[model samples]
Target: MVTKKAPSAQTAVDVALAELVEGERRWAAIPLSGRRALLDQVRALTGRHAQRWVDAAAGIKGLAPSSPLIGEEWLSGPYVFAAGLGALSATLEVLERGESPLDKARFGRAGDRVTVDVLPTSPFDMLLLNGFSAEVWLRRGVSPAAAKANAGLAQREPSRTNGVGAVLGAGNITSIAPLDVLYELIAHNRVVALKLNPITDPLLPVLADILAPLVEVGAVRLLTGGAEVGGYLVEHNSVDHVHMTGSARTHDAIVWGTGATAAERKLAGTPKLTKPVTSELGGVSPTIVLPGQWSAADIAFQAEHVATQRLHNGGYNCVAAQAVIVAADWAQKDEFLAALRAALAQAPARHAYYPGSDDRVAQAAEAYPRAERLGPTGERLLITGITPSPAEPLLAEESFAPVLGVVELPGTGAEFTAAAATTANEAFAGTLGVNIIAAPATITELGSAFDELVENLRYGTVAINAWTGVGYLTPTAAWGAYPGHTIADVQSGIGVVHNAWLIDRVERTVVRGPFRPAPRALLHGEFALSPKPPWFVGNKTAANTGRLLAGFGADPGWLRLPAIFASALRG
Candidate 1:
């Protein structure tokens, strides 16, 4: 057996700091046009090596090398990176013409705040990502005019640049680490030295290939490391800022300390690393199933929608629906549950890929001994209860495994929606993601009432008839918690990422999709959906669908739609 150890963080920092400072200087000095050119190169490289990138990520995660399910690695991986490149390039292009990227985007008024429509920006995206649209609700008092001036702070205020940032890559997602680094480069004008997660560090070399153009220009550096390397990088004087995608526990230890006295220090507002820190931490996300006149087909579509949201990535997702809230008095509660159970029961066995996932699964199983084992291999589990108190493990903690707990509450229409919103806000520990599943008729009946319902939810990203992960992938949607969390109680951690539009201080992003794309995209498996969704693991055509989607996103055209639909039809 052989072993590889990360270099001493101190030594790594010593070697890189001088060069990083110079890189940061050069990064800032580069004009908007130059930045656009840099991103153009990144986009080309990402598309050029898309398959190889997906292959490397899928292999590491133990997915079948050619399995359509590996489409997760493709869409969430290279597709996201390539999409970010295009979006960031457009943002810089706006700046080159002395315009605010925020102003360049379309906006509308949502209550007191201004909402910028972030996605489906062109006829191309509309033709491609049909049935999906996203908008970022700016923080209150941020008028559309103010939004333009406040956007792209780094370019507007050059003095605010933090020279070099250390991005601690997350093991779970292939694209997150690279995309996080790109934000520091594009938004803050900071050169980055990214320390890849030990769990997925091997993918670093492959990512390096996609990001070679940026690395060549000294915009990014890739490093391999474990806790020691991460600790060193965060504490090193040379590293001016840090960001992460992990647990609040990790963020605390880094921002506070590791000793027995860590908790007291955290309470006292004492110090550890003084450098500015930002993170995308995990949370116990919830989905509220609003009562509707759902037909049998609609019930089944939503069942898979809820189950697939949970089971995606083998349930090791921050946005995974760990908690489900349903109206107890609804006529179709049992029907929905039966459909959901049927979907979960048919789950294909997946490797509990993340470290410590088995223990977490066992813990959830122990907490709810009555929980059903959904898969033959026992990789998936379901915990059912009638609104367990907020203190229950199912509600308080992130399962981070294939365990979903359902809690039922009383109500029908407005009453049900209100109670569901309250439950998701107070009962769930995270403010990361939430889904509101309701029919268009129900919404139309609610009319003006629906807007308030959307406003009431505190989660960072709210999705209607879709997964909050939609907001995560949309380059315009700010991905993080619903604002106003300090380092002390950092629920879903702090800050936002994947916001390539260069807007700032986002409150939340709203993404809405048809319950089913066209008639039976999720029901009879027929759809008008373009760039067919990759989240459906059972779709036999998922791999081809993913490849076609990646192609369409990179180069949207009328010529490509026929082929994309052909592949989508095969599923």
Candidate 2:
């Protein structure tokens, strides 16, 4: 019997890059219709393998098949990915008809910036996500005509060719890698060589099957290995551009080589890697709870929302809420904190699956020794009475774990909003995303000042009455750090992805949802039918709802609506 050695990581990377380089021009020159067809194939394959994908992810995260937490895998994996592909497919359809996707989109002005309504693009979006709204705010000086002309610039001249690009897949979220691949293929017009993070190696088989259509066409090549493979692909001669969804530490090491010379290279503005790079590096995201005359129900609901923001995916998310800002003088502050503690305590226990999560949590504990340990296994940590100062460790670092911190500020209305905004801007380590939770009456009271504050907030996505994860999942909304970081300082990285409409010069994506769910919203005089979002960690019917939603997303049809609604209403 002859024994064959496994192909080495370097050799595998070489083969993948070679394939992508060969297909680079072909992929870029393919017509929009052909691209859309490929997406259809991917969506179909994803639907077929959806269950296996979620199962594998759940197993990795220590979630049993029967665990409601399995719903997280389903929603973050096949469901959101299918939705993203569907969104991209729709954009390609419009492009094929010789029209910009934004031609019929609603446009408005936020301050001096032009804003295009991205959500509610279809009747289904309006019906299913009734009160949720999102807008892509263009950079200042971008006229409406300019925004229209810039949308889907790559697709307009379908035969134009860009070179091969490298995508460094994120490990935490199953959908992130696939969505990044889609973005590179459709929005950037690049054939991709994707290197899976070692931590997500278990997903190799599932992703290969889901992205089989692209792999077959040579438009994409998915490889798996450690940092050696990633370094090889990014530095390869054939790769023209690079995109990554990871940490600032990783981004810095990639751009400026590590060790003794790293600081020197940074200060001298000399990156070891010369290729143009884009990244979605997360920072210490904040949840600003604006003071409102919140009722008992309001406090409880919003507390759960805050908990969901911090505990989703076991808080391994780049945009997870780390610092929660609330008015110290607000009468309901103590009540809200008590409710949040209860929510955290009641949350299902989850293993710390991510590498270094235990160390990170330990570091937080060291920084705040008095931090409360919540969760069934005491896996969740909460540090309260955080002063709004840059010296605070939570304010300076991104704790990508089930750790939450509360920062207290003085004043109310615009006064509190301004202070909270200032702390969020100056203290947070990154600019990836932020969340603002405000009651309807409070927003109405603040009015134009509120709008101005939102406009001025320097983050990639500003989520109102919703977690920043909502913006991340919304394909139309641009996802990245606030524009203006360089490779040296690389805060939250740079550039945007998952922008289905392909709008150029994006400043930020502002997403807003109802302050409360249905029945409660009605009681608060807000007209929205949305129930507890399936992504909520405490959502009891999430497993069923997420499954139905995944099917609908993959193969959208009117027939699927009732089942989804039935499951969601119970949650």
How many clashing residue pairs appear in each of the predictions shown? Answer: 0, 0
Point out where model 1 deviates above 4 Å: 1-9, 157-160, 386-388, 520-532, 555-557
The model with the greatest lDDT is 2
lDDT of 2 by residue, 291-369 (tens): 9898888899899999999999999999999989999999889999999999999988888899989888889989899
Candidate 1 lDDT over 392-448, as tens digits, reads 778887778888888889878887777787788888887888998888778888776
| TM-score between candidate 2 and the true structure | 0.98
Candidate 2 regions with alpha-carbon error over 4 angstroms: none
Cα lDDT, model 1, residue 273: 72
lDDT of 1 at 333: 93
TM-score of each: 0.95, 0.98
